[model samples]
Target: MTEERNSLKEFFNYLRHHDLKMETVPLKEQKDYQHPDDDVDFHAYRILLLIFICGILKPTFFDNFTIYGRGKFSFYDFLIRYPFYLEKALRIKNKEDKIKDLEIKHYETEEAFSPMIRYIRGPWDHKYPDILNYMVSKNLITVHYSYFNKSQKAFCITLTDLGLETAQKIQTEEPIWTKRMEAINAIFRKDAQNQTIEMFVREHFSTLILGNAGE
Candidate 1:
Protein backbone atom coordinates (compact mmCIF):
# COMPACT_ATOMS: atom_id res chain seq x y z
CA MET A 1 0.00 0.00 0.00
CA THR A 2 2.83 2.35 0.89
CA GLU A 3 4.63 1.67 -2.38
CA GLU A 4 1.44 2.19 -4.36
CA ARG A 5 0.72 5.45 -2.59
CA ASN A 6 4.24 6.68 -3.27
CA SER A 7 4.01 5.85 -6.95
CA LEU A 8 0.65 7.59 -7.25
CA LYS A 9 2.12 10.67 -5.61
CA GLU A 10 5.11 10.50 -7.94
CA PHE A 11 2.87 10.29 -11.00
CA PHE A 12 0.90 13.33 -9.86
CA ASN A 13 4.15 15.18 -9.21
CA TYR A 14 5.29 14.32 -12.70
CA LEU A 15 2.21 16.04 -14.13
CA ARG A 16 2.83 18.99 -11.82
CA HIS A 17 6.07 19.75 -13.60
CA HIS A 18 4.00 20.26 -16.73
CA ASP A 19 1.65 22.56 -14.78
CA LEU A 20 -1.00 19.93 -14.07
CA LYS A 21 -1.12 20.75 -10.35
CA MET A 22 -3.99 23.17 -9.77
CA GLU A 23 -3.97 22.91 -6.01
CA THR A 24 -3.75 26.70 -5.89
CA VAL A 25 -6.10 27.59 -8.74
CA PRO A 26 -9.62 28.62 -7.85
CA LEU A 27 -12.65 26.85 -9.30
CA LYS A 28 -14.12 30.09 -10.59
CA GLU A 29 -10.94 30.82 -12.50
CA GLN A 30 -11.09 27.40 -14.05
CA LYS A 31 -14.72 28.05 -14.95
CA ASP A 32 -13.69 31.28 -16.61
CA TYR A 33 -11.53 29.30 -18.98
CA GLN A 34 -13.67 27.29 -21.37
CA HIS A 35 -14.97 27.23 -24.92
CA PRO A 36 -17.61 29.78 -25.84
CA ASP A 37 -20.22 27.44 -27.34
CA ASP A 38 -19.85 24.94 -24.50
CA ASP A 39 -22.75 25.07 -22.05
CA VAL A 40 -21.66 26.64 -18.77
CA ASP A 41 -23.61 24.06 -16.79
CA PHE A 42 -21.81 21.20 -18.50
CA HIS A 43 -18.43 22.85 -18.95
CA ALA A 44 -18.22 24.34 -15.49
CA TYR A 45 -17.16 21.07 -13.89
CA ARG A 46 -18.37 18.14 -15.95
CA ILE A 47 -16.11 18.60 -18.95
CA LEU A 48 -13.02 18.68 -16.80
CA LEU A 49 -14.26 15.57 -15.05
CA LEU A 50 -14.45 13.82 -18.41
CA ILE A 51 -11.01 15.04 -19.42
CA PHE A 52 -9.44 13.83 -16.19
CA ILE A 53 -10.89 10.37 -16.62
CA CYS A 54 -9.60 10.20 -20.18
CA GLY A 55 -6.15 11.34 -19.10
CA ILE A 56 -5.73 8.75 -16.35
CA LEU A 57 -7.06 5.72 -18.22
CA LYS A 58 -5.03 6.35 -21.33
CA PRO A 59 -2.20 8.41 -19.76
CA THR A 60 -1.51 10.15 -23.03
CA PHE A 61 -2.62 13.51 -24.38
CA PHE A 62 -3.16 11.77 -27.72
CA ASP A 63 -5.66 9.20 -26.54
CA ASN A 64 -9.35 10.03 -26.11
CA PHE A 65 -12.19 8.60 -24.03
CA THR A 66 -13.60 7.02 -27.15
CA ILE A 67 -17.31 6.54 -27.81
CA TYR A 68 -17.08 3.47 -30.03
CA GLY A 69 -13.88 1.58 -30.50
CA ARG A 70 -12.16 -1.80 -30.38
CA GLY A 71 -11.05 -1.30 -26.78
CA LYS A 72 -12.54 -0.67 -23.34
CA PHE A 73 -13.23 3.01 -23.99
CA SER A 74 -16.51 4.84 -23.88
CA PHE A 75 -18.54 7.34 -21.86
CA TYR A 76 -20.72 4.41 -20.82
CA ASP A 77 -17.70 2.83 -19.17
CA PHE A 78 -17.19 5.97 -17.07
CA LEU A 79 -20.83 6.08 -16.00
CA ILE A 80 -20.58 2.48 -14.79
CA ARG A 81 -17.07 2.76 -13.36
CA TYR A 82 -17.02 6.21 -11.75
CA PRO A 83 -19.48 5.31 -9.00
CA PHE A 84 -17.50 2.22 -8.13
CA TYR A 85 -14.24 4.13 -8.14
CA LEU A 86 -15.74 6.96 -6.08
CA GLU A 87 -17.03 4.55 -3.47
CA LYS A 88 -13.70 2.78 -3.25
CA ALA A 89 -11.68 5.97 -3.06
CA LEU A 90 -13.85 7.54 -0.40
CA ARG A 91 -13.75 6.01 3.11
CA ILE A 92 -16.03 7.01 5.97
CA LYS A 93 -15.94 5.93 9.60
CA ASN A 94 -19.05 4.60 11.31
CA LYS A 95 -20.61 5.11 14.75
CA GLU A 96 -19.23 1.79 15.96
CA ASP A 97 -15.73 3.29 15.69
CA LYS A 98 -15.10 0.73 13.06
CA ILE A 99 -14.75 1.48 9.36
CA LYS A 100 -17.92 0.69 7.51
CA ASP A 101 -17.14 -0.19 3.92
CA LEU A 102 -19.00 2.10 1.55
CA GLU A 103 -18.48 0.24 -1.67
CA ILE A 104 -21.67 -1.66 -2.52
CA LYS A 105 -19.46 -3.93 -4.72
CA HIS A 106 -22.31 -4.33 -7.18
CA TYR A 107 -24.26 -1.67 -8.97
CA GLU A 108 -27.76 -2.42 -10.29
CA THR A 109 -26.80 -2.92 -13.91
CA GLU A 110 -28.15 -0.78 -16.72
CA GLU A 111 -27.11 -0.06 -20.26
CA ALA A 112 -24.09 2.28 -20.26
CA PHE A 113 -25.86 5.32 -21.72
CA SER A 114 -28.99 4.85 -19.63
CA PRO A 115 -28.02 7.35 -16.96
CA MET A 116 -26.73 9.99 -19.38
CA ILE A 117 -29.71 9.78 -21.66
CA ARG A 118 -32.04 9.94 -18.69
CA TYR A 119 -30.10 12.64 -16.87
CA ILE A 120 -32.26 15.71 -16.40
CA ARG A 121 -30.36 18.95 -16.21
CA GLY A 122 -31.35 22.40 -14.92
CA PRO A 123 -34.60 24.39 -15.19
CA TRP A 124 -34.96 23.85 -18.94
CA ASP A 125 -34.59 20.09 -18.75
CA HIS A 126 -33.51 18.31 -21.90
CA LYS A 127 -31.52 15.26 -22.81
CA TYR A 128 -27.90 16.22 -22.92
CA PRO A 129 -26.37 15.87 -26.33
CA ASP A 130 -23.99 13.00 -26.79
CA ILE A 131 -20.95 14.27 -24.88
CA LEU A 132 -18.81 13.55 -27.91
CA ASN A 133 -21.15 15.70 -29.96
CA TYR A 134 -20.56 18.60 -27.63
CA MET A 135 -16.83 18.02 -27.58
CA VAL A 136 -16.67 18.01 -31.32
CA SER A 137 -18.86 21.08 -31.59
CA LYS A 138 -16.55 22.98 -29.26
CA ASN A 139 -13.48 21.97 -31.27
CA LEU A 140 -12.01 20.14 -28.29
CA ILE A 141 -11.94 16.87 -30.20
CA THR A 142 -11.78 15.44 -33.68
CA VAL A 143 -13.88 12.37 -34.43
CA HIS A 144 -13.87 10.00 -37.38
CA TYR A 145 -16.96 7.92 -38.08
CA SER A 146 -16.06 5.03 -40.27
CA TYR A 147 -16.60 1.30 -40.67
CA PHE A 148 -13.83 -0.94 -39.36
CA ASN A 149 -15.09 -3.99 -41.23
CA LYS A 150 -18.04 -4.96 -43.43
CA SER A 151 -20.59 -4.65 -40.66
CA GLN A 152 -18.92 -2.63 -37.96
CA LYS A 153 -18.95 1.14 -38.02
CA ALA A 154 -16.84 2.94 -35.40
CA PHE A 155 -16.18 6.41 -34.18
CA CYS A 156 -12.66 7.19 -33.04
CA ILE A 157 -12.20 10.08 -30.63
CA THR A 158 -8.93 11.97 -30.61
CA LEU A 159 -7.81 15.30 -29.26
CA THR A 160 -7.37 18.29 -31.50
CA ASP A 161 -4.21 20.32 -30.96
CA LEU A 162 -6.40 22.90 -29.23
CA GLY A 163 -8.00 20.13 -27.22
CA LEU A 164 -4.53 18.93 -26.32
CA GLU A 165 -3.66 22.40 -25.08
CA THR A 166 -6.88 22.59 -23.05
CA ALA A 167 -6.17 19.19 -21.55
CA GLN A 168 -2.80 20.51 -20.41
CA LYS A 169 -4.58 23.45 -18.80
CA ILE A 170 -6.93 21.05 -17.02
CA GLN A 171 -4.05 18.91 -15.76
CA THR A 172 -3.25 21.41 -13.00
CA GLU A 173 -6.91 21.57 -12.09
CA GLU A 174 -8.63 22.01 -8.69
CA PRO A 175 -7.43 19.95 -5.70
CA ILE A 176 -10.51 17.79 -5.08
CA TRP A 177 -10.41 16.59 -8.69
CA THR A 178 -6.73 15.78 -8.22
CA LYS A 179 -7.49 13.50 -5.28
CA ARG A 180 -10.27 11.83 -7.24
CA MET A 181 -7.79 10.96 -9.94
CA GLU A 182 -5.44 9.42 -7.40
CA ALA A 183 -8.27 7.40 -5.90
CA ILE A 184 -9.31 6.28 -9.37
CA ASN A 185 -5.84 5.04 -10.20
CA ALA A 186 -5.71 3.21 -6.90
CA ILE A 187 -9.02 1.49 -7.60
CA PHE A 188 -7.95 0.51 -11.08
CA ARG A 189 -4.70 -0.88 -9.69
CA LYS A 190 -6.37 -2.87 -6.93
CA ASP A 191 -8.82 -4.72 -9.19
CA ALA A 192 -6.46 -7.69 -9.49
CA GLN A 193 -9.21 -10.18 -8.76
CA ASN A 194 -10.69 -9.46 -12.19
CA GLN A 195 -13.77 -8.13 -10.48
CA THR A 196 -15.64 -5.64 -12.63
CA ILE A 197 -19.27 -4.64 -12.89
CA GLU A 198 -18.44 -3.63 -16.46
CA MET A 199 -19.15 -7.11 -17.82
CA PHE A 200 -22.91 -6.66 -18.00
CA VAL A 201 -22.59 -3.08 -19.05
CA ARG A 202 -20.29 -4.19 -21.84
CA GLU A 203 -22.57 -7.02 -22.84
CA HIS A 204 -25.73 -4.95 -22.75
CA PHE A 205 -24.04 -2.29 -24.82
CA SER A 206 -22.26 -4.66 -27.12
CA THR A 207 -22.68 -2.20 -29.93
CA LEU A 208 -20.19 0.08 -28.24
CA ILE A 209 -17.80 -2.71 -27.30
CA LEU A 210 -18.16 -4.26 -30.73
CA GLY A 211 -17.88 -0.93 -32.55
CA ASN A 212 -21.40 -0.90 -33.96
CA ALA A 213 -21.24 1.46 -36.84
CA GLY A 214 -24.66 2.60 -37.94
CA GLU A 215 -25.74 0.11 -40.59
Candidate 2:
Protein backbone atom coordinates (compact mmCIF):
# COMPACT_ATOMS: atom_id res chain seq x y z
CA MET A 1 0.00 0.00 0.00
CA THR A 2 2.84 2.40 0.73
CA GLU A 3 4.33 1.71 -2.69
CA GLU A 4 0.95 2.30 -4.25
CA ARG A 5 0.62 5.61 -2.40
CA ASN A 6 4.05 6.75 -3.58
CA SER A 7 3.29 5.88 -7.19
CA LEU A 8 0.13 7.97 -6.96
CA LYS A 9 2.16 10.85 -5.55
CA GLU A 10 4.60 10.60 -8.44
CA PHE A 11 1.70 10.62 -10.89
CA PHE A 12 0.59 13.95 -9.51
CA ASN A 13 4.16 15.16 -9.76
CA TYR A 14 4.18 14.26 -13.44
CA LEU A 15 0.83 15.97 -13.98
CA ARG A 16 2.27 19.10 -12.41
CA HIS A 17 5.12 18.93 -14.89
CA HIS A 18 2.47 18.83 -17.59
CA ASP A 19 1.01 22.15 -16.30
CA LEU A 20 -2.19 20.78 -14.84
CA LYS A 21 -3.18 22.86 -11.81
CA MET A 22 -3.74 20.06 -9.34
CA GLU A 23 -3.31 21.03 -5.69
CA THR A 24 -1.16 18.90 -3.44
CA VAL A 25 -1.46 17.70 0.15
CA PRO A 26 -3.36 19.72 2.70
CA LEU A 27 -3.33 19.85 6.50
CA LYS A 28 -5.96 17.18 7.00
CA GLU A 29 -6.00 13.81 8.63
CA GLN A 30 -6.85 10.62 6.72
CA LYS A 31 -10.10 10.48 8.67
CA ASP A 32 -11.08 13.82 7.18
CA TYR A 33 -10.98 12.30 3.74
CA GLN A 34 -13.28 9.50 4.70
CA HIS A 35 -17.04 9.98 4.54
CA PRO A 36 -19.32 8.72 7.24
CA ASP A 37 -20.51 5.97 5.00
CA ASP A 38 -17.14 5.60 3.27
CA ASP A 39 -18.91 6.27 0.04
CA VAL A 40 -17.44 9.08 -1.96
CA ASP A 41 -18.00 9.25 -5.71
CA PHE A 42 -14.85 9.89 -7.76
CA HIS A 43 -14.21 11.37 -11.21
CA ALA A 44 -11.18 10.34 -13.27
CA TYR A 45 -11.88 11.37 -16.87
CA ARG A 46 -12.47 15.06 -17.40
CA ILE A 47 -12.37 15.04 -21.21
CA LEU A 48 -14.76 12.14 -21.61
CA LEU A 49 -17.11 13.52 -18.96
CA LEU A 50 -16.95 16.74 -20.91
CA ILE A 51 -18.70 14.87 -23.70
CA PHE A 52 -21.90 14.75 -21.66
CA ILE A 53 -21.35 17.84 -19.54
CA CYS A 54 -20.99 19.89 -22.66
CA GLY A 55 -24.57 18.89 -23.21
CA ILE A 56 -25.84 20.40 -19.94
CA LEU A 57 -23.82 23.55 -20.48
CA LYS A 58 -24.57 23.58 -24.22
CA PRO A 59 -27.10 21.49 -26.13
CA THR A 60 -24.99 21.33 -29.28
CA PHE A 61 -22.55 19.14 -27.37
CA PHE A 62 -25.26 16.55 -26.71
CA ASP A 63 -25.92 16.04 -30.40
CA ASN A 64 -22.21 15.74 -30.99
CA PHE A 65 -21.95 13.18 -28.22
CA THR A 66 -24.49 11.06 -30.09
CA ILE A 67 -23.77 11.87 -33.73
CA TYR A 68 -20.00 12.39 -33.82
CA GLY A 69 -19.77 9.62 -31.23
CA ARG A 70 -20.77 7.32 -34.10
CA GLY A 71 -17.15 7.30 -35.23
CA LYS A 72 -15.68 6.71 -31.81
CA PHE A 73 -14.55 3.13 -31.14
CA SER A 74 -16.36 3.11 -27.80
CA PHE A 75 -19.65 3.95 -29.46
CA TYR A 76 -19.14 1.38 -32.20
CA ASP A 77 -18.66 -1.38 -29.62
CA PHE A 78 -22.16 -0.60 -28.40
CA LEU A 79 -23.55 -0.86 -31.92
CA ILE A 80 -22.37 -4.22 -33.27
CA ARG A 81 -23.43 -6.96 -30.85
CA TYR A 82 -27.22 -7.16 -30.62
CA PRO A 83 -29.40 -5.01 -32.82
CA PHE A 84 -27.02 -4.55 -35.72
CA TYR A 85 -28.91 -1.39 -36.60
CA LEU A 86 -27.82 -1.60 -40.23
CA GLU A 87 -29.74 -4.86 -40.40
CA LYS A 88 -32.50 -3.86 -37.96
CA ALA A 89 -35.50 -3.74 -40.29
CA LEU A 90 -35.45 -7.34 -41.47
CA ARG A 91 -34.29 -8.91 -38.20
CA ILE A 92 -37.21 -9.72 -35.90
CA LYS A 93 -40.82 -8.87 -35.11
CA ASN A 94 -40.17 -8.92 -31.31
CA LYS A 95 -36.49 -8.40 -30.67
CA GLU A 96 -36.83 -7.89 -26.91
CA ASP A 97 -38.59 -11.18 -26.48
CA LYS A 98 -35.93 -12.86 -28.51
CA ILE A 99 -32.98 -11.40 -26.58
CA LYS A 100 -34.41 -12.17 -23.13
CA ASP A 101 -34.90 -15.75 -24.18
CA LEU A 102 -31.31 -15.93 -25.29
CA GLU A 103 -30.08 -14.28 -22.10
CA ILE A 104 -31.80 -16.92 -20.00
CA LYS A 105 -30.23 -19.75 -21.95
CA HIS A 106 -26.84 -18.06 -22.15
CA TYR A 107 -26.71 -17.47 -18.41
CA GLU A 108 -27.77 -20.99 -17.61
CA THR A 109 -24.71 -22.53 -19.27
CA GLU A 110 -22.05 -19.82 -19.13
CA GLU A 111 -19.91 -19.81 -16.01
CA ALA A 112 -17.95 -16.59 -16.53
CA PHE A 113 -17.92 -13.40 -18.58
CA SER A 114 -15.61 -10.49 -19.11
CA PRO A 115 -15.64 -8.47 -15.92
CA MET A 116 -14.66 -5.36 -17.88
CA ILE A 117 -18.21 -4.87 -19.09
CA ARG A 118 -19.53 -4.74 -15.54
CA TYR A 119 -16.70 -2.37 -14.64
CA ILE A 120 -17.68 0.00 -17.41
CA ARG A 121 -21.06 1.40 -18.47
CA GLY A 122 -23.89 -1.01 -19.09
CA PRO A 123 -25.49 -3.79 -21.06
CA TRP A 124 -27.94 -1.44 -22.73
CA ASP A 125 -29.54 1.88 -21.84
CA HIS A 126 -30.91 3.58 -24.90
CA LYS A 127 -27.89 5.65 -26.01
CA TYR A 128 -25.35 3.35 -24.32
CA PRO A 129 -26.10 0.26 -26.43
CA ASP A 130 -24.36 1.75 -29.42
CA ILE A 131 -21.17 2.38 -27.46
CA LEU A 132 -21.38 -1.02 -25.76
CA ASN A 133 -21.59 -2.77 -29.12
CA TYR A 134 -18.50 -0.93 -30.30
CA MET A 135 -16.57 -2.17 -27.26
CA VAL A 136 -17.56 -5.75 -28.03
CA SER A 137 -16.52 -5.56 -31.68
CA LYS A 138 -13.16 -4.14 -30.70
CA ASN A 139 -12.72 -7.20 -28.47
CA LEU A 140 -12.64 -4.86 -25.53
CA ILE A 141 -15.66 -6.77 -24.37
CA THR A 142 -16.80 -10.31 -25.05
CA VAL A 143 -20.51 -10.12 -25.80
CA HIS A 144 -23.55 -7.85 -26.15
CA TYR A 145 -27.28 -8.35 -26.67
CA SER A 146 -30.24 -6.02 -27.10
CA TYR A 147 -34.03 -6.31 -26.89
CA PHE A 148 -36.88 -4.20 -28.25
CA ASN A 149 -38.23 -1.08 -26.54
CA LYS A 150 -41.47 0.89 -26.67
CA SER A 151 -40.37 2.24 -30.03
CA GLN A 152 -39.73 -1.35 -31.10
CA LYS A 153 -36.05 -0.59 -30.67
CA ALA A 154 -33.65 -2.95 -28.90
CA PHE A 155 -33.27 -2.39 -25.12
CA CYS A 156 -31.88 -5.44 -23.32
CA ILE A 157 -28.37 -6.96 -23.55
CA THR A 158 -26.00 -9.84 -22.79
CA LEU A 159 -22.25 -9.74 -22.32
CA THR A 160 -19.62 -12.27 -23.51
CA ASP A 161 -16.86 -14.26 -21.76
CA LEU A 162 -13.99 -12.06 -22.85
CA GLY A 163 -15.59 -9.12 -21.12
CA LEU A 164 -15.60 -10.88 -17.77
CA GLU A 165 -12.01 -12.04 -18.16
CA THR A 166 -10.86 -8.51 -18.90
CA ALA A 167 -12.60 -7.21 -15.81
CA GLN A 168 -11.15 -9.96 -13.63
CA LYS A 169 -7.64 -9.41 -14.92
CA ILE A 170 -7.82 -5.69 -14.26
CA GLN A 171 -9.39 -5.99 -10.85
CA THR A 172 -6.91 -8.65 -9.72
CA GLU A 173 -3.70 -8.94 -11.72
CA GLU A 174 -3.15 -5.37 -12.89
CA PRO A 175 -1.51 -2.64 -10.86
CA ILE A 176 -3.23 0.13 -8.90
CA TRP A 177 -3.53 2.52 -11.85
CA THR A 178 -5.32 -0.10 -13.87
CA LYS A 179 -7.73 -0.78 -11.03
CA ARG A 180 -8.38 2.92 -10.56
CA MET A 181 -8.87 3.34 -14.29
CA GLU A 182 -11.50 0.66 -14.18
CA ALA A 183 -13.09 2.42 -11.23
CA ILE A 184 -12.98 5.76 -13.00
CA ASN A 185 -14.50 4.48 -16.22
CA ALA A 186 -17.16 2.82 -14.13
CA ILE A 187 -18.04 6.14 -12.52
CA PHE A 188 -18.33 8.06 -15.78
CA ARG A 189 -20.49 5.41 -17.39
CA LYS A 190 -22.80 5.57 -14.39
CA ASP A 191 -23.43 9.24 -15.24
CA ALA A 192 -21.78 11.55 -17.74
CA GLN A 193 -24.37 14.33 -17.51
CA ASN A 194 -23.24 15.54 -14.09
CA GLN A 195 -20.22 17.80 -13.50
CA THR A 196 -20.76 18.12 -9.77
CA ILE A 197 -18.97 14.82 -9.40
CA GLU A 198 -16.01 16.16 -11.34
CA MET A 199 -15.82 19.22 -9.11
CA PHE A 200 -15.66 17.03 -6.04
CA VAL A 201 -12.83 14.96 -7.50
CA ARG A 202 -10.86 18.07 -8.36
CA GLU A 203 -11.26 19.52 -4.90
CA HIS A 204 -10.63 16.40 -2.85
CA PHE A 205 -8.19 14.32 -4.84
CA SER A 206 -4.52 15.01 -4.23
CA THR A 207 -3.40 11.97 -6.19
CA LEU A 208 -4.44 9.87 -9.18
CA ILE A 209 -3.44 6.40 -10.25
CA LEU A 210 -1.37 6.95 -13.43
CA GLY A 211 -0.42 3.45 -14.33
CA ASN A 212 -1.68 2.32 -17.73
CA ALA A 213 -5.45 2.98 -17.95
CA GLY A 214 -5.65 -0.79 -18.38
CA GLU A 215 -2.97 -3.16 -19.64
Tell me, by lDDT, which candidate is best: 1
TM-scores for all predictions = 0.39, 0.21
Model 2 residue 176 lDDT score: 32
| Model 1, position 145: C-alpha lDDT score | 65
Report the Cα RMSD per candidate.
Answer: 19.8, 21.4
Error of 1 at 28 (Å): 25
Candidate 1 wrong stretches, greater than 4 Å? 1-45, 56-85, 88-130, 145-155, 189-197, 200-215
lDDT of 1 at 207: 37
Question: Each prediction's Cα lDDT score?
Answer: 0.42, 0.31
> Candidate 2: TM-score?
0.21
lDDT of 1 by residue, 20-120 (tens): 75467675666465543344444423444444443323333225443334222333234333444244223311122111332233442322212322111
lDDT of 2 at 35: 34
User: Residue pairs in steric clash, candidate 1?
Assistant: 20-171, 20-172, 21-172, 22-172, 153-213
